[model samples]
Target chain A: MTERFDFEGNAWVLGDNIALDGELMELKYALARETDPEILRHQIFRGLDPTLAERIRPGDIVVTGRRFAHGNPHIQGLIGLRGAGVGLVCESIHSGSFRCAINAGLPFLPRCPGVTALVKPGDRLRVDFATGALQNVTRGERHQFDPLPAELRRIVSNGGWLPTFRQRLAQQN
Target chain B: MGQTLAQKILSRIVGRSVEIGEIIMPEAELVTVHDWYAANAARALDEVGVTELFDPARVMFTTDHEPVAVSPHAAERQQRVREIAARLGIGHFFDVGRGGQGHVFPVELGYIRPGMYIAGYDTHVTNFGAVGALGIAVLTEVSELMALGSVWQQVPQTVRINLHGQLPAGISIRDVAQKIIGELDPDLIDDAVVEFAGPGLRHIGIDGRFTLVNTPTELGARSAIVEPDEIVRAYLADRVDGPVELPRSDPDAPFRAVIEWDMALMEPQVAAPPRPDRVVGVSQVSGTRIDHAYIGSCASGMIEDMRETARFLKGRVIHPRVRLFVTPATNRVAAQMAEESLTGIIQASGAVLTPPGCGVCAGGRIGPVAPGEVSIGTGTRNDPGRLGAHDAQLYIASPATVAAAAITGEICDPRGLDPDLQPREAAHD
Candidate 1:
């Protein structure tokens, strides 16, 4: 199935480019060490806020900074965010992390710096990615963006080129 | 005025062309401010008449350079980022623990994408090129443009890095990056995009690509890119729709510089303090003692990194004098390491594994060394205050080298370890 990502239903509208405005919330270390002998051995991993993890649903849009997927480029982080049903619209991103997200099939909206200023976390938003216009369902705000080139929008809205191609194939079939 | 890629991308998000390096007007798309060089962007935005124009939805903030907030005043300065983000209606804020260094988290959340342009206060923002986007670090002029919804830019000349052979086992993506940076004069590719090509890239995972792409700034390049492949398709399948095809440079495309590297004969390279370009092989630093070791960050914080550490530390204890910390890049990587049983091997080796933030790479996030301390790890930017105090010295190395040093408390070749040693059983999910 070619999963498609559109800004449907209620979405928060941010008018400016406030893509990066969230709590740091680094995963908790499993253990505390003042001074440890082993340099390469230990059992600590990044932990996340269960609440935050659960708060996000699929298709939710995350507005963020340039290098959003900075550290590790862990597929887990991408999967967790994607599984929560959130899409991303940020200003910039790290290359490796971008690949991880794309490979994971996450819906990403790049160069949408105004998203942060246009929407709130819970504000209902509807995005016509084809037209690059996002409507804030909650605050009755309407924001227009330079719509993606029709082809690019198809690729993006259809969840990337593969899905878009599959959808095209289906139409032909 | 004709539009550049930056202007084109920005216009789609914002409604107009914003004056670059000028006072704000209101069409800015997304704005990012870091502790380092943030004042420049802030001042630029202010000068452009944008006291608070960022659309909270389009702003992302991170504290990297001096990981520790430094002075209470510095903490206050950092706090201002949140205040500004909130005041400007910014929705995403990565206060310390929430997001590790700026280069690591935003992309993990799926915010940054391909074919976009980004401006940050720091030089390293160019790391965004790995996913085929143009990441540029600019002064406040661009910040204000972000606030006003636009910035000016010229289409960058491009450079191509063609790989001809596979990397030898026990080698890492970091080595490739360091080797390239070391061999290529920093000035040759200045203000240009460096794209990765050839079959050699296939052996490298995304983490490896991050390592290579992260250091374009040091090379004086504008950005870095790796052509999208099936690996990208498979990775993106679960997130959005399905297989997607992204653009890659043409094989015969004009390039400002072209370099070919054979991965098979490549040796692990290290970037010594004070310059990433000062590269050397493991044989050169043999027996060089280290005080601290870290294995984390977007550059080296993946499952492959953990496995490499385990392979080096298998059935061995860390040197008594060294303090080694291993932080996975994210929760999933840590879980995967556990499942792969690499975590146990690492634990049995006596290293202290940390949580998934940007641990110790930028110094302030986890634990920074005191003055005169020396540490080796797979983190980025060994600048002053990069770890804790500005005087602390950091040596950037591969995960293998970092792990080997952690285990031996001295610089040691990771290849000395038994490569045939099998990893532990996979852990139950």
Candidate 2:
């Protein structure tokens, strides 16, 4: 049940204010209460880029500008992104979305002030979710940002909130 | 190095000094879940193999979302909710007819006190901030608090907003809230606790302050609180049994940013469809046709809003083309409306009175607008598909503005209506 703390992946860069409700995944899927990741993976970025989901490979990276996942804190997008086996590095993310990312077990670096300018689409990148070390292999660029708080990291690394809750129960018992 | 009100409350809870961005697990004074998420919370608790709550006395459940249980499925859900509450030994259960909206009634019942920290499953829990309480929207995380007794929270930086001057006649505090959110920089408010202060606050009453505190969550603020003042004290004096602790921020409190607003310059605002922040002066959208109008929600369903609507629609009727629905926030508000004859006046004016709950704002579970129809309301958000039909256009404004639109069948400036019947004392309500 251990998730990787560090990984290398192909980069997919996006702009700011990418909303979670309509742009990430269709709102209807979330309304329908679709939780199976395998079924949701195809809907990731389906609205913005119809073919992007098919193009995304496992262990890929999504580098976004300020206010990534800006709208309603629906976790369907995070669930789908996790299903696509990708991690995220954004200049900023709303607190609600940050919670959803952790709950969905999506590895992300939520604060990288100039990350969008440093990385380009299709670039090879390496990210350490534990240390917030981001390296752009294709461009020979490196940047560091504050990692997720240790308490929150434990939740994400434990594969989302449910497993963490189960562990808490076990500890109490 | 004075701490803001948020830090003060968190520090009191954690039994230690807390700084901004520091993660701390503080026991919640109250944990609330509504009918919409009650079953999911029960399932989560079951999956985690936890059968007991940390303290049943601190936990509350309310059936406000689907108050009437229109469908068989809804009725069955309510039945399961009752069973879950019974099984968990929930201390406070506000069934459909007992309590109104979970957000509004808690304040009316005096469960929310100054400096108290609450964790709620719904975003509008910020409504409790009207009395200086911090009610963070935990969403599905309420289950964790229910089982573990505490949830982790980062002490958020406070955005200090100083208000001055008096609002012009006919303009509601909702307009001031909308204008503030529309004008403030997103970076200043994003994930920050908005603290209301300055002289203008004295002019806003409890219900108006509720609208002020409730609106900022739509702008991504973690929570909003008004520094407890005489107004809060006078409101809670009779409602609460214990000596109220009114906390105030120090003169040198650390604030992420300070923005001062002159309420005199404020105008009636409408958040056009597709987003709540897409705000414009009412004159800009005047004459826009609307088929439906609503004057309720956690944001604007107070008795003050009811009185304001009654003032506008007193001897007149809503346009025949428009269907107006007025929902009081709680049973207390409904009763107050009845006592004041506001209900009869509104009903005589052709507006329908829905149950004293979320009404049409609960995803349009009741009185949904048809597809392609335009509507205006006093609800918190105007997001697409927010009122049932994805294609249906929705605009957000104050109850006075909605009533004005309901009478005119279009988005007209409320000030353009009868001058003698204007809501001059709405601020004092």
Question: Each model's TM-score?
Answer: 0.61, 0.97
Taken over the whole model, the C-alpha lDDT of each candidate is: 0.61, 0.89
Interface RMSD of 1: 16.5
Tens-digit lDDT track of model 1 for B14-104: 4565432222222333455666555555654554455555355776676554445647977887777666656566556666556555665
Best by lDDT: 2
lDDT by residue (tens digit), candidate 2, B157-224: 99989999988877889999998888887767999999999999989999999999998999899999
| Model 2 misplaced stretches (Cα beyond 4 Å) | B419-429
Could you report the Cα RMSD, in angstroms, for every candidate shown? 20.5, 2.6
Per-residue lDDT of model 1, residues A1-173, tens digit only: 44465756434223321211122222221112111212201211123233444444555566664445543223434444444556666655544344445534566665565467666767777765456667787898887765433434334445542344335334534
lDDT value, residue B243 of candidate 1:
39
Question: Clashes per prediction?
Answer: 124, 0
**Model 2 DockQ (Cα-based):** 0.75
Give the TM-score between model 1's chain B and the true chain B.
0.82
